[model samples]
Structures are given as C-alpha cells and as structure tokens.
Target: MPPSLLLQHAPCARPTAKRTASLFSAAVLASKDGGGARPPRPRPRGKPRFSRQSAIRKSFQQEQVVFSTPVSPDPTVAVIGGGASGLACASALAARGVRSVVFDTGMHGLGGRMATRAVDDERQLVFDHAAQFFTASDERFQKLVEEWVERGLVREWRGSIGELEAGGHFRPIHSSTPRYIGVNGMRPLADAMLPENDLIKVIRPSWISKLEPFNGLWRLFENEKPRGQYDAIVIAHNGKCANRLLSTSGLPQLTKQMKRLELSSVWALLAAFEGPFPIPHNNSYGTFEGAFVRGVDSLSWMANNTRKLFPFETDRPECWTFFSTASYGRRNKVPQENIPNATAEKVQREMLGGVELALGLSKGSLQLPFYTRVQLWGAALPMNTPGVPCIFDPQGRAGICGDWLTGSSIEAAVLSGISLGDHVADYFASCGERPEEFAIGLDDSLNRVEGHDIGQFPGLDSSQKPQVAEAQLTATI
Candidate 1:
C-alpha cells in the first residue's frame, strides 16, 4: 500500500497469528488419527498483522541509499540546548554520518521541560515537575516512540485524566489516544534518545552565552571562554536565553524570526500529602491521576505523581503537582534563580487555595503537606507559534528548532529537530550549494497545521484542543 494511504489498524491482530498456528497443529494431529476430524478452519483475512513499516520507514526504503554520503566530509555542528529538539537533531545528524556537539544548561541532566525532581528525604519522593506526558500524532514521531517502547525506555501512561470544573465536577477525558512517559522519568527518555556514537558529543552543565561569526564559521562562547567553532549551528531552545544569544549573532533575519515567538510564564507547585484527595468519582474510569482545572485563576492543572508512577500502590504518600494559570503566573512572577521567601509562601497559599476551590473543599480543609516546593517557569510554553517545521538561515548556516516553532508538545520538538537535520544533510549532499527545496517549512504555499497548546491555556474551556486551521498561524519565518 502507498505510504500515505496506509491505515492504522488495531493492535489486536497478533492473537490471530497464534490462533492460526494452533489450528494448523490441530489439523496435523487429526490427520494422524485416520483423518476423522474436520479440516482446520481457513486462515482469517483482511487484517494486516502488526507491522513496523511506518510512513517514515517507507520514505527511507524508497530511497536508493538511506544515508547518502555528504559532499563536505567531516563537517561538525554545534547544537545549543540539550533538550528534546537538540538531542533529536544531533541524533538525526549522526545517522547521516555528521558529527555534532550538544550544549545544555541543565545542572542535573538534560530534558528541559521533561524534568523530574527527586527529593532526598526519607519519603523517597519523586515528581515529574514539568511536562506531565506526551502524545505522538505524527507518523515519524510515532515510529520513534514505538522503538522507545520496545527498548523499555518509554511506556504508556494509562492513568485516568480529565477536567476538574470550577464546582468540583470531575469529567474524565474520553479518548483512546495513547499518552507516553519515560519508565523512570521524562529525563531518562531524553538521555536514552541521545545517539550512542562518537559522532555525537554532549557537554552538560554548560551554557553557550554568545555566538560569533568569524571567517565563514560560527564560534560559540561561554561568557569570556570560547567554546570551539563549528561549520553550522542549530538553536534548539527558545525564550530569553535564545533571544539574547541571537541578538548579537550577526544574523538579522534569523534574529527577527526568533523575536516573534512569545512565551508564557508558569508556576508549578509540588506538595506531598499524607493521603489522596477526598474527591468522589466513578469507579469505572479508575482513580484520577491528573486533571486540568477550569475557571480557577491560581491553578490550572493538578496531578498525582506517586499515583502516576505506581497507580496501584495506595500505601505510599500521595504527591500532587499543581500548575498556576498563565495569567496567575504573570501576576505572581518572581526571579526564577532566587525567589524570595515571602513570594514563595504567598504563591503557595494562593495556589493551594485555588486547589481547594477546584476540589470544592472548605477553607483550610486539606492538611498541611509534608514537603512543598515552588518553581517558576519564566518561558514555560509559547503563547503562539510560527506554524513552520523549523527556521534556517543558509547564508549564516544557522537554524532554530523547538516546540515553540511548531506547537507546544514534545512531539513537535522532535519533529522539528529531525526535519532541520534532514534539511541540513540535504544541503551538504549538494556540495555547499542550497538545494532546490532550501527549507520545506519556509514554503508559504504548503497547507500546514497551525500551532496549538498541548496543555491548558489561558482562555480555552477544553483542557486541550485540536491544532487550528492553517489560517490560525499566518506568521512566516
């Protein structure tokens, strides 16, 4: 079947193969008994067994060579931000026989928003503080996710999640769409996706403060110290850091495009309580692990971290993470690196009050948490997007890829990174000449999906909505 025409079939077809084998063995045994038994039932038809042939796989299969030889030999790339997009870009480039170095500011590990906090207290508390979970809608990303599942690095998060209305009404989100998370935590998944080869080098706990173009190469610097130069550079992060780095990078067009992205600040509150919330729910959908709070100013989301990790383990202390609304975050914004004690206490009080309202509990009904923490995401997520897969500057040999470029999701960041890697590989295959299709995302005529928030937004009634039409994202790179 044509790649695009292939339909997604149910995963239950594997049992049919086992059934057919049993029937064939039974027929042999009956034949040995003087053919007294009836012939075996005919093999079933019309269903394809589980297959690994995704659209992305088929596209590569059609090509003469999966990894074409690059015209420029041994070209090195510098990828800033070791998040999903940055790691994915490095992986893609490595597959094409190119080398890359990834730079990140993560003190503990990589996986920017796919973060986790492990408390050293005796309670053995762990929390997926940032992105709760991710869904794969694109074929390319689906293929990668499937591979990760087989390798035991990722698993489906089947926990019950839905909307928590203002008056404490719990409505489960009714969708079969699979939600995925790392086996240990979101950060490990990002760590696993890093290419296991010498071609990809990672420098963690390092920040690239500036980029200087000198003699046809981009030189990266960390404050006063110089981090080696590279033939090409890919900016795989957004927000203030990216803007400041690009402002003096000598790439006016790319800088202009980067400045167009607007990000929203968000506050995340993590607390460990002695027991679960006393909210009532139907037993059919399972215990609520997460919820998107609606009509609540101080809170926008809440999830049970302990339940998400061990859904059946009821004896453990319940750890819940809450997120403040964009507007609330803006109003109560504080310095991220060093938040004041008074501000933290106020935010905790107000957000917990909001949580009480979401659960319809009386004031001060909930018990004090055993452990509590507050973090402010200055550039939590993008408010809007450019609706492009990625942005690249051929003349400056620079590119930008992130969830902010396409949509607010881990899948978007992966897709954008892979696309830019392929685009650059194609450019090098042509011997330093820009290909006819310089960048597919730069084409304005193509019908592309607009950027949509994967999580709760400022004004959306529904927890999440489908990606808007092409008209919604009219901004061009």
Candidate 2:
C-alpha cells in the first residue's frame, strides 16, 4: 500500500527498522503458535509502507517556521532653544535614532541671534540683520560648512574690511579666507537640521517656565501646564535664561555657579538704500574714540544680494547690515521704536564723510532709498572666563551644555553639544538602568508630604499631592 493511503487509514503511525524487525519476529512467532497462516502481526499496528513521504512533510513544516526581527527603542531628548546650538543637538540625536523636541520662544522662527528681516513691497526682499558673518574654526564644523556651501546654502564674501579707530582714522584689515553667508537667509541653517516628523517637534511661542524631577522623569512645564517629559534636557539658550531655569529648579551648586556669568547686549540697526553708498568693498569697522558713535560705513557689509549672494532674495538690490558699537548698545536702554531715526542720521553723516574722502562725493551727490530698524539683544554673547568648567556634571545625570559653557561662538556650541551627547551615551552604558546613574542625595530629597510646595513652579496652583507610595511603605515598616 502507498504511504499516503496508509497515513489516511491510520493518522498515528511510526516507521522504524527496530519496529519492523520486531513485527517480523512477532509474525513468525504467531504463525508457529497459530494453527493456520500467521495474522502478519496485525500489520504492525499502523506502520507506514513508504517512510520517505513522512520525512518530506516534516521537512516542509520546519521550513514554514516564521522568525521576527527586534526593533530598537527611541530615546527622548528635550532641546531648550531653536538656535544653532539646539538645532545641532537635535540633528545629532536624530541621526542616532533618537527623538528630540525643540522649544523656542523666538517668534515662530528657528534662528535666535542669526536673524533676518522680510521687506514688503511690489518686490519683496529678505535681509540678514544679525550674525553678519560666520567662520568655521573646527574640522567638524568646517566639513559641515563645506557641504552647506556645495548645496548652495552658503557662499563666501570676499573683501577687505576697513577698521575705524576711536580717533576717526580708518585702516584696512585683510582677511585671507572669505566670510560665508547663507544663500537665502541665516535661518536656513537651523531649518535644515530639523527632522520632518515627530522625531523633532518644534514648539514656537511656547516658553518653558520650569523643570522638575517627577517620578524618575524630568517634567517640563509651559505656562503652568505640563508640556512634556524628557530623558535628557539640553539648555541651549543664553546665560540669562539658563541661569533662571537652573536657579528656579533649586539646584544649589548650579545656581551659585551660574550667578557669575555675565552676558553683553547688542543693538542692531538695519537699513536699505536704492543707490550704493561710496565705500571700499566690505567696508566695516570705522572707529570714533571721542564721538558718541564709533564704527560707520555706507555698505557696512554689502552684497549684490539679488545676484551675487546665493541665499539672498534675487528681486532686491544690494543688501547691507550695520553693526552698532558696544557703547551705543549699552546706552540705548529705551525701546526699539526710538532707535532708528537717530542711528540712521548719525550713520548717514559718517558714511557721507567717508564717501567724500574715498570718492569725492558731496552730501547730496548720493540719491538712495533707505529703510532702518534696530534690535536690542539683551544677552548677545557670553563671557568665557578662565577656570570655568564647560560642563557641570555634579549629579552626573544633570549636566549643562551651551555656548556659555564653552567659548562664545557657534563652534563652541556645536562642540558642547557633541561633548554632552557623548557623556550621556557613556552614562547609559555604565548604568544598567536610568536611576542607577543618579544617587538620591539627602540634599536632593523631596518633602514627600501632602499639600506641600514640592517641585511646583512659583505662582502655580499646588493642589496636586506628591505620589509617595514607596515612601509611605518605608514609613509604615
């Protein structure tokens, strides 16, 4: 009989050499015992006639077994600023398969100090008012900048800047390498680093009021409401905001150290004119020691932004940015509305005088259409003092990384992010779990009592009680 017929007749059957031999012996023994022909040992109870068919079916079933691949978990990080520092942090985390959320109070845009303005008219124009130019000082940043240049997002500005002395003398300072600017505007650099989806969620018009440790997670509050939680937080803003956040959290060591940081302010004046002012190419930094104002230039830093400038708007004429002196920045304590008229008049007079000296142009010889606006940067740059640690890892888990932590430059910000990121990655490797990395100190202990002001922000309602089930059990025992 065929194996298929035999299997159909008896679902449970075995085909083995020992069993076949035993069945043959049993048949012979039965034949001798019985009077007539042996019963053939009852057909060996249900052995298949063809054994190969059973092996093929077993092999087929084995081949059909399914296997699953495991997926890695995504890490959560919170970036406090949307400026260059924060953007670089988010980008680095995203590249490592981590998700980051960037929060910025700056007007719905990415750039913090690297700001630009949009001019409205029959033909629109975008001009960069802040961060007049940037240079790459590190290999990592330099390589990234080269890539940006190749993509046409940035281009080199080639010219000699004439430095103005405090005594009204102007001298030219030569820069070997060209200064680079964004092709369209400075904000594109920040925009390019953000992820498309929730991997990087940018929250604009939302300011983080306070941060506290809640149930082993860092909870961030915005406007007294729980915004979100993060495994790690990167404060990329200026020293003032950083100091405020650290102090409000009640971290004594960080608070005490952050008090020493001092940030300088910058007041910027933006203007647009139809005709080009007579000045040397890349004319910048004219000094006036005795006068109220210091530096003056017609085209302080100008490019035929319409054509030569890669990232600038092509529909507009040459774009220029005039920088205010540090003295002017300190004196201008009033609002922005009152700054433009005085700044423009003073700068125009200085530029006209310089033009007459350079190109023999009288005051009325230049006919130009101009627009002026001023910006006051409360914390433009951070003072990098010696003996200051770039990162403060007092609690090991709690760390500070930003431009203020290192040198006050874009490169320093990037380096700070990279350094902190490595520290965080190494920290996870050392600890089996998150809590193991941070020892709960007596000073860091919570009140754990009900209706207490535990970890609540100032002026916020403290109705919610602390979840102390673990503490309650310890007290009961």
Candidate 3:
C-alpha cells in the first residue's frame, strides 16, 4: 500500500502507518484485558494565550538560495534548527513573500525531536524515539492539524492516555482533546509542511558554530566557514544551542534570558522484541498507545510504537520506545569516554528495569529486546518557559520561538513560530526602504484567543501539557 494511503483497520491510532504495520486488534485486545479508570489531574496555568490568523499568499518570484547573497528589495531571514519552530517560521515568512533560509544539523531529515529509527536487526521494525504524539488545544493549531489530517500527513491517536501512579499501578484519564501524530513517523509531518518554494530555502548537516553581528546584519559561521549574511536571525533551536549562539550575538538582554533559561534532559531508548508484543497490559491502568509513570524511579514514558503507529502482525519484531525521567536523565547524563556500549548498557538496563517493575514481568518471562538504541537529549525539555509568545528584539534584529516560548508540545512550537513571524513581519515592513503592503499585520485579527490575558499583545495560551510522558517531549529556544 502507498504509505500515504490511510489504514481503515488500525486499532490504537486512527491513522494507518505511512510506511509499516496494519491492524492492531491483538495488541488493543491484550491491553483491554487489563484496564482500569483514573481521575484527570487539574491543568496548569500562566501560559501565553495564543490567538492569531494571519494569511499572506506567496508573492515572491525570486529564486531560492542555499546561502544568502546580496538580494535587493527582499531581506533574508536565517532560521536555525530545521525542526517545528524553524520550519513554521520559514513557512510563515514564505507566505508573506519574505525570504528565509533554514539551516539544520540533522543528517536524517528536518524534524528534530519528531524522529524515527529502524531496528538494526529488523528493517521493518521502527520506533519514534523522541516526540510520540501531540494534542491541538488552540484554534490556530486546530486548523493546521485539520489540514494535515486531510492531507494524510497526520492522524489521530486515540490512545487511552493514562497516568501511572506509585507502585506500578495505572489509571485512565479521559479528555476531549485528541492527540495527533505524523503518519509514518513524526519527522515526515514537519517535512511535509515545508515545501520547495522560492521563499523558503533549506540546508542540512550544516551546523552553525558561531553567530557574529556584522554592521546591522548577522553573519553565520558554519563548520568554521563564513556562511552568509541575513537581515534577521531567528533562534529556533532548543534552548541550550540557541543560548550558546545568542551569547555571541552581543544582545545582552536576549542572551541573558536564554542563558538563564533551564531545560530538562532526557534519555530516549528504543527497543525491539523478537516477535509480536512480549509484554501484556495490566487491567488496572487500561490499554494506552502511550502511558506515563509518576513517582517511578528513573522511568518516565513507554510506548508500543508498532501498535500505536503501524499496527501489523508480521513475524517481524514489535517495537517500543522508552524515555527516562528528567531527574534520572540529569543524574546520568555525562560525556562519552570512548568506551563502546558503556552508556548504552546502563541506560538500556535502567529503562528495561523500569519496564519490568511496571509490568510485573519476571526476568525470564519478559524476553530481552533484540534491538536497542540510546539517544541523549540534553536541554530536551524547557523547565521555566517564558510567558511571551516570542522574543523580537528590533535593535538586535533577532527573534526567539519554540515550545519553551509558548508551551511544550507540537502545537505550542508551531504557534510560537507563527507569532514570532507576525512580529518580524511588522518590524520588517516598517523599516524597509519602501513600504510594502501586507495582507494583515497584527490588526485586531491577531487578537488574543478568547479569555486569555496576555496583556495588550496576543500570546499563546498557557495550555499546560497535562501528560508529559506519553504526550511527547517538551522545549523550545
């Protein structure tokens, strides 16, 4: 079947796998055998209430460039990190007939945390090691997610999202907010949103090692070579990397804000079993494609990727992804010392041990994972997110956007970009050599989402992330 063709038989996620898997009745049935109900936790507050609907048709006719050159009339915006925030910013700029170049460090593809990997032994088995699923709570995000759903780029995951309490017990928490995921994997969703347009250009495996201010423009140095000159620079990276670059930009306030910002680290582990699921679900917690554990030592989240995404019953191994709690990640995150499998051994054991205790699986009963991989995500999650939708310093000609600016989750990341784009657009137009008319530039139409108190300017709602473990990774720049 074409990867884009939707599956009509998947059990957990409403959308069928874009590349692998089929029906997951067996997995869902097994989970149903051990199900229980739990109460919902109250939501957190103090997030920037997001509300905006700006539309700008593509109008720029100039050719796209890999590295910025002298382009009259059109200004260049360099966006670091080709993840959700970066792409969203580029896309928004493209719609406004603006020019932008995206620089990414990932060799695999654009999506940073929305990543996927194949098990070494089994080519068919795959896992989304970083971001698992996302929810749409804002109107702007809801509209975009709807379009993605219609385009087959995204699907709804009706995983019985539940909370794991103390002592390995589980409880199901009901919610109207539907969680969505990329069809094949998370990366494809971000990739699909970015089209090969004249307004937006992309460069991969290009890491910006230094950021220097040249006169009124910004010059980027990638791999120790002078890359290009950009009229404006958007820090779309996770806080740590962005903070590092901003420190050299000579923007004291912005650099200080990003530097003081703290983030949570995460150790993501992907494992594949020999055959169909080797573990059974416990009835007390209920069956969930994604689940989170609270008060559990070192363990944070676990997912049945095959069942949650592809849902096929092939003799091939089933895949699962595990994440360590922020606390555990901080304690164990250390530089590699050239010893092969040293970091892998300890992380893998810690994850597996958490799984064993959570499932009550005896060492022998629970088969060992045939395939395993460990990824260190430092500054993975934002701890204290700023209440502003984005940071736009006109004097600095630099702006900041990410989940951290808005709130964790894909929705927040996208919203942050859009909001930042609006600010950049207004600033760009007002200072241009000749004023150009824009479709809508934050005039009433960009009013705050109803009931949100973001002070005169509209900002993202502090729509708190209710479930961190299964809901996905958190952060922004």
Candidate 4:
C-alpha cells in the first residue's frame, strides 16, 4: 500500500460572481430611451459601494491566496485473512515501518484452518482438525522458524515418512530437517507473526464483503457497512473471497479470470479414545475400500491434549483426527450440514468398521464426545494448468500471490509473497511518485525476467570442495 498525503484545509474559497461584478462596476448608469438624457439613479440604501482601488485590491488578494495540497499519510495496510499468508504479509509490512491490520471471520481467538475443536461435553480434550503440518524451504523462512523454536512457539515433528502403498514400495524415511508445529497447534505461528495489542490490531468475527477504491484510498465494507479506509489492501484468504470482493468493484475481466479457478472440499473427523491408538504414532496412509484416506499419527503430529499448551487434558486416553481426500468427498456427496467432524466420523465408520473400531475400542468404551464438523475449502489447491503464469501480474498495482500462484505448500506461499512484494517495491521505486488508479500490464517486464534461475551462495554450491559428511550435514540442515 502506498502512503497518503493529508490536506487539513480546503482550497481557497471563491467570491460570488454578482459580488465581483458589483465591485468592478462601482457606479450604476441609467439609460434614456427615445427622449432627453436621464439623471443617474440613487444606489440601494444600506449597501456599501466598492471603490475601484478596493475592488482591485480585493481581486489581487484573492489571486495571491494559495490553496495547500493534501499530503498523503504514511500507508496503512489492511490484510484480509489471519492465516499464515496474511500474518506473514502483515509482518513484512511492519518490518518496513508500515502499519497494518488483519481481519478474520473465524472465532475471535482462533486462527483459520489451523483450527482446533473440543471433543467432550465436559470440554476436556481438543484436537487440531485442519492443516496437519507445514514445511519451510527458504533460508529466510528457516531463520524465522529458528526464532519460533527459540521462543517455544513451535517444535519440530522430528519424524515424517512417505510410503507408496503399491508392492510395499517403501523408501527409507527421510526426516525433514525441521518440520515445525505450533506449541499449542499450528495457530501459534500465525499468532507469533502478528503484532501485540497496541501495535497491530486483529479484528475477528469480521468478514470483508467488498473493497472499493475511492479518492486514493481503499474502503473495506463488512456486509455493506463502512468499516474504514486504508492506503493499501492485501487479500490473503482463498481465491473465492478475493474474487468476490474484486468482482463487486465492476472489474469484469478480473472477475472472469477469478471465476475460472476451482476449489475442493474436505471432511475431517476428530475422535477421542480410551486407550492408546492402534496405529503407530508416526502415522499411516492407504486406500481403505476405495476410499483414499490418511490416518495421522497423532503423536508425531503432536495431537496430545494433555500438554499444558493445549486447551484440554484430563484422563482421556488420546485424541486423533482423520482426513478424507477431495475425491472421496465428491463421491460421498458429503452434505454441507455434516461438515468436518461429522463427515470425518462417517467416513471413518464406513472404512474402519464403524466409529467404535476406528477409535480402536468398543462402542461403549467412551462417550461419542463431539459431533462431526465439515470444512469446505474453496480453492484448497490450485490445479496447475499448462501455460499458466507462476504469478499473474495483470495490473502492476495488484498482483496475485499465494500457494496457488507457485505450488501447494507453505514454502510456496512464502516464496510467492516475497516475489510479489519485491516486484511491487521495484515498481513503486521506478514510478517515483504515487501511481494513478489504473491497471498497468507487466507482460514485458515478466518476459524480460523469465528463465532466470536461483543460484546458491558461495561455499554452498556442490561444485566446491567436498566437506566431511557431518560438516555438510550441519551446514545443510
């Protein structure tokens, strides 16, 4: 968002034309028609007449009065979505000395998709039923992760293995260098990036319905109510929300492109057990009766409610969350009513011989706890189509940045944000002054920079002298 200049005073006020003409005429003359000349009429009483000198002085003073121009205030950025991407953008803006605010529709304290749910009536246990985990592939991101680790905001999952079910083709488990998780859940990472109460403001249970650019400022509306205005806006949520807002602004071409994109939905189940889960704590994956599903190792994913950081504990044995693929979601006709938890439970029961067996216990082993919930992820993953730009730079003023812009991963989102942010910075620097409200196509700029490959720093490239395996390990990790 670009900064705005504020003008405290209105432009110089002008005098009425009648007043100006009267001052200029000074004296009124009477005309005699077809007869002898007539004498001048008396001027109106109580009205002061202006001398020629006074009139000239008044006009000169008016000409000399200068109207001050409004100077824009420092750019105040508004970020929509309290997810990782939104928080990251806010943090980046803050680091640049730009103030920002984040708005989310989720529960006041909860973060999007890194959501947690309670299972029992007593509200004893909770589980993270949204994003399982995230990975970082950039050095800058890694440094941020290190800080998170130091502050105990996150912890490494330690063990992550991918197995191909066919022919028992299992590759040796390659531990991710540092797969991070929130101390309480994945929400902490988002929370950490946001500013404290005084610095950054987070508005929850609020959703932006429209964004209108007016008089060099963006006005955000919530259900048609005027929220406020900002110098710039960052739409960090899914494409659907962004598209909806952009569509209302009468941008037909942008609306058409946004509508072309598709999204998928998922059904997740959160269950509590009376004893240790039957599956290994590390996690497992396979197709059960044609249903492509994943049974997460709650332990590896840090799904323990007993931890002090988590909301609930008590004597509950364990809590586990299961997820079904988008394909399965389509086939089962999962109704909107039975979102997330319910859908998760139904799928689990169908594949694993009823909910009781899925929890690795008898029907009467424990209370059913919480009802199932379903989460519909519109634009969950972007389908990579041929000829699609890695980043769509339609209007230089606005650019698309998200996991969908690059690839599906936390790293992709971060990389896309950084790239787009850099592009915007460069564009603004080149402009030298505030840009007019219009879309400037960057087709040529993108073409010129295309095909550039990222290179590793010196001493980091493989072509250099080989080092001891341990030394390499320390450096690489």
Best by TM-score: 1
Report residue 220 deviation for candidate 1 (angstroms): 0.9
- Pairs with steric clashes in candidate 2: 164-285, 164-286, 164-287, 165-287, 166-289, 183-310, 183-311, 183-312, 184-311
lDDT per residue, candidate 1, 63-181, as tens digits? 11112222234356789988888888887876665567789999999988888888988887888888887777778888888888988988988888787777677878766678787
lDDT for each of the candidates?
Answer: 0.68, 0.46, 0.60, 0.43
Candidate 4: tens digits of C-alpha lDDT, residues 157-247: 5432332222222222244354455677665566776644232467887889976544434567898776665545666666656877766
Number of clashing pairs, model 2? 9
Give the per-residue lDDT digits (tens) of candidate 2, residues 1-477.
001111111111122323323432333211122221222122223522322211112221121111111111223567788777677666655444345677888784886765667777655555665654566666666777787787788777554333343323455434455556677777677676554434456788678888664323356788667676555566767556677787655344445545655544454445566654444333344321111112332222222333334333443554544444333444553444355666646654544443344333454665554665545565654432322223433232355556555444455555566555445444433332443443222122112222110111112122233222211100000
Candidates by lDDT, descending order? 1, 3, 2, 4
**Whole-structure CA lDDT of model 4:** 0.43
Indicate whether candidate 2 or candidate 4 has the larger TM-score: 2
Candidate 2: where are CA atoms >4 Å away?
A: 1-74, 165-170, 195-198, 280-315, 335-369, 386-396, 432-477
- Candidate with the larger lDDT of 2 and 4: 2
Candidate 2's TM-score: 0.62
Quick one: RMSD of model 3? 17.2
